[model samples]
Target: MAESTDPNPAAPVPGLPERILLGAAYYTEYQPYERLEADLDLMAAGGFGVIRVGESVWSTWEPRDGVFDLDWLQPVLDGAHARGIAVVVGTPTYAVPPWLRKTYPETTAHSATGVEIPYGMRQDVDYSHPTFRYLAERVVRKIVGRYADHPAVIGWQVDNEPGHKIFYNPQVFAGFVEHLKDTYGTVDELNRRWGLTYWSHRIADWSELWTPDGNSTPSYDLAWRRYQATLGHDLIRWQTDLVRSLVPADQFVTTCIALGQQGQDITVIGEPLDVAGANLYYATQDGLELPGAQGLEGGLASFFVPWSGPAYLSLQADTARGTRQAPFLVTETNATSIGGTADNFPAYDGQWRQTAWHMVARGARLLNYWHWHTLHYGAETYWGGILGHSLEPGRTYAELSRVANELTAATDALAGLEPVSDVGVLVGAESRWAMECMGPLAGPAHSWMGDPGSYDRILAAFYRGLFDAGLAADIVSPGQLADVGPGLPDDAAAAALVARWRVLVVPGLYIADDATLDLLRRYAEAGGHLVLTPRTGYADADAVVRSTVAPGVLRGAAGVHYLEYTNLVHPVPVTGAGWTGAGTAWADGLLVDDAEVLAGYDHPHLGQFAAVTTRVAGAGRVTTVGTVPDRELAGHLARYLARTSLPVDPWRDARPETVTVTAAVNAAGERLRFVHNWSWEPATYRLPAAVRDVLDDVALAAGELLALGPWDVRVLRETP
Candidate 1:
């Protein structure tokens, strides 16, 4: 557990951004004060705030551990503070001082396979080690104590993403075993639940247990799912707790969770920290090529919906595979990744403008561009940065600045507005972890599924249905209900879909959290009309709770007694609501009590819950689609959204697949629609009349057809 402390006072709350809050990180190590000062001039003019001051200058900061240096950095940070800008100082744990590593060789860890490694991976350190913790705490206290009150210090970034190269630390074994015990209480219980006796992996005592070695089952195999997420999360949590003591409560302490797949368990990782910040790089040449966790839509939904608090785009890298080979950084906004680089220039000013607004609308509290200036490699090679090697104010700089100025002016309106959504998507980090583990590439589970597209197919199809229907949504993770202002006031009644999203598109969720389960029980009992699929409230986060038996928890609220059976198929010629075609679907059968089956198997042998509905919880309706919905079921989804009074006027005229949409409702019950088109070609369209496209100043009249160019977006606003 971390000791409670107050963080540094951040910069003035410059109101809610009408557009996205634009910022750029300044890498001061590569340049002198003069260059930084010159760059600061452009930064201020471009309306940039919040510079991520890094601790990478170990050689510059300390000649030795105790001897700290701030001579070079003082002026830049102080100057920025004087100019009313915020500085998010980074604690440099990524690059350990060579002396420290050489002196304490143990700092370099031994892998699970038992190999003594040297200084080859960057940002690699075992979090389970007490010695490393001591050093990290000492260094953090020193830096944070010194600068906690500094006017410029608004946030403290605790170590870059934890992975040094495949977060394969020896700590995994210790941490995982410990987490399993803490969660399951007894080794015998763990053994029984995991069905380990069958595999000859049964445990006689907790001490005998350990994370499986180099070659073993994936950590997510339903039996070990909770233990796996908890294990990965525990390591991250331990490090964050150490940081909490040094930083203040006001000065948010956060770490970036990059490298999605095996390296970091983001959901569990942030449990010990304050800010759930993410480093999102859309369509970039970045590495870490994991299938289940990559792609633009997946990345956005994964990060945005899960963290139930204010968010910051921590480190968005800017780069291009062009002749000049430059990347944009230091600041966000402006045109696309095109500037001094040849063939990669901004296509149109308006496109970037809309992108900025769309991100803000989605839910970015602060957006930091990757690098402010391209660092001079001291004659090695030039890389990613907003400004090129010449240090000229590239075309993007001016354009970005212009957008910043625009956002600054509009912050007043933006701050007053809140998001509105009716479509509900359940995000389960543990389930995602399970899915990843189940995949063939790495980790656990043995499945012959040719590709690992099952997860994406289901999630993306739902996203598209919402878009075509023009219903924005407040996507929720299992434990995120408390995030939407407490007490669920009347004004916010429409937006009050916590456990299950209010009433619209309550997706048949998998692997639920206790909080989510309890919330849904309360919501359903309160008169919410809900549709339940086969697996509603089936498995807990651990992928445990196999069969929902009588007197067993979660069976009552879900209103279904799910029987354990596998290999169920979707009913063909499925014609329920608007779905009437051959579509493949995963099925789960349950004995219905209070719920009515809307669509299901008409055959004798195949008894699956295709679709069902029940009116429960505050005039809310629940519809659970039995299996992963196929793309052809979009019309059925649309019909459900319409029947439930979900706002379907936003992009209703547009093709169901052209774009994706999610909606939200503010305190005033005003519907705010977020439309995203992730295609190569541009799209053009007239947004629905109920809402206004404040971005391009377009009004969508009902029944009016408009063609949204490729990759275009429109925020349709309406009233509930």
Candidate 2:
């Protein structure tokens, strides 16, 4: 086996390098056979330390059923090992070979409508099919057993992002039925929980149940999502276990959580991996509001705006880190533009550098672009890389080389660095799925007319609020706070976790179980501050509305109850808490009990009820927002809570659109601050304290005004 780059290689099985890793996805089998030596020379010149291969080429490895062609990969591995470059191998099960597919047509994934998906795209096979299992096992065992002893192999990626598709074949349907039987133990219990009596949709027999595709019932839809997530989790865990058994203890096993899209439960699939890895691509074009402009929503739009990139990247990074309680790897990111567009935008000079450093700031241990060289032919042919299609060094390669050199020189400055945040934003797939069933509050699913008012949009706005307030925060998941059972006392752990953050904000948490509710209660009772926006705790884990009251289970903690709510077509005036602004979308007519009114509607009739209320549950406090707060008001509430309810002093003068700041600390007790100018115009920023720039070793006095050009970033090391 290969040794690590560290001097003390016996320290432990490190997940990634202590120092940052810079590399690209290299392919030796694709086309226009690259001169291996020349490419390696260019990579070495760029100061790359690793290359990821063997991910997208299962057919290349096994052209026929039993014929394993392993000789072609050895030269690539040996050459990289000779040049001191580590390799991360992958089990190529994502793309089924043509021979296997033609032989077993039943292995193809079927849609919810019972239409089979053809075999052109990757991951089109039914993962749970018996035929697929037998073939995949043979391929994975052979590849892992063959390369387990390769000196250059340092890591293994289980499969390329395992949660992209949903399968609905006969096997999957039977599995779902079996899963329901196991969960509820009886058809009667399932019928009762799903409220089948509402429309005479009760289940009489196990086979009578249909897939929840066209169903509008929230409970059935939620169960379907849960079942789908279970499948993904099991599949990934199985692959991870197989790889772990084959590889040595020193080599890490992981899979990339691609794009932060929540088709699969991230927390579940990530539980079995050693390190959480993800692929991210942000907008390279200037002034592109992608989520709104490109129809991508719910934290999927990276680089929508200047601050949007950092906000979304931080969200995904925090989600990954929270999954494993450790730093993660950027296994796949854009070398240039991404996607299957005819003409995609390119990363301008300094843009890729900014994106890379921002990801590191948010806690990425390794950074590798998707592919080394742009493809000459494929569906992703237009997706450019560092080397253009001509196999020559281009502008991207030049910029990447500069970034590589700088990272190599200043590696010591970033050693043992970790992000420290004083705020946590709780999110989950259950809530997203629940909202999807209810559809967007803006009426039709396809209409963006009310795009300003959807469940995910509101949550994204809350996250953007924290970003605009210059408060560092982590996007926490409900699974992170879930109970580990067996008398583990999840309440204590949940309290302690929330105690680390000054504020815990739950945005649009529609489906919350009792355990989660109790955890939130324990947090508030133990002197932790929390903020709950609209639609939190309205339904249970089964997606059934609670009969007690609106915001059930959390009403006691919120110190208020509401029975009625309305969707506003236009903005309504709101006044309280030393701020006056208009609220939009929905308004809950709350009945205040022990809670103090923080804000109230300016309407004559609705003004009687509280718009926002703050209550002290025990030693801690909880604030409930009755309506959707706009950007300005959201920032106002964040500042108000941080200043009055928490012990953090948020950064001053960091504007939402123009200037942004993120800070972290190293093991040596030194603080590293990233101050960015996201605007396209020159701006001046006054230093918060006297500090030295780690990049250039320049010292500046406290309150010294520094002028920054467009898209400029300064890495400052706080000096006492």
Reference-based lDDT, each prediction: 0.50, 0.75
Candidate 1: lDDT over CA atoms? 0.50
TM-score for every candidate vs. truth?
0.72, 0.91
Give me the displacement of residue 95 in model 2, in angstroms.
1.1
lDDT by residue (1-720, candidate 2, tens digit) is 110011111222344666687889999787587588888888887888788999889898899988898777888888888887888998898898889888889888887657888778898888878788788888899889988889888899988878677777888878888988999998899999989888888989998897756676779878887887787787789899988988888899888777434458776677788887887766565522212221223232233222344556556666666665566788988787676544466766666777777777777778888778988888888777878888888888887777777777768888766776767788878888778677335644445334323666667667766766777676667876553222446656655655465578999888898878888877887777878888888888899988878777678888998988887777788888586666777888898978999889888878988888989878788999888876667777877777766554334543435676777776685888887766567678778788898889999888787666666777888899
Deviation from native of the Cα of residue 683 in model 2, angstroms:
3.0
Give the TM-score (vs. native) of candidate 1. Answer: 0.72
Candidate 2, superposed: residue stretches over 4 Å from native:
1-15, 259-263, 287-309, 443-453, 482-495, 602-609, 648-657
Question: What TM-score does prediction 2 earn?
Answer: 0.91
Cand. 2 Cα-lDDT: 0.75
Q: Write the per-residue lDDT of candidate 1 for residues 403-473, one digit (tens) a residue.
A: 67766765544543434334445544555545544421211243663124344344555554444344444
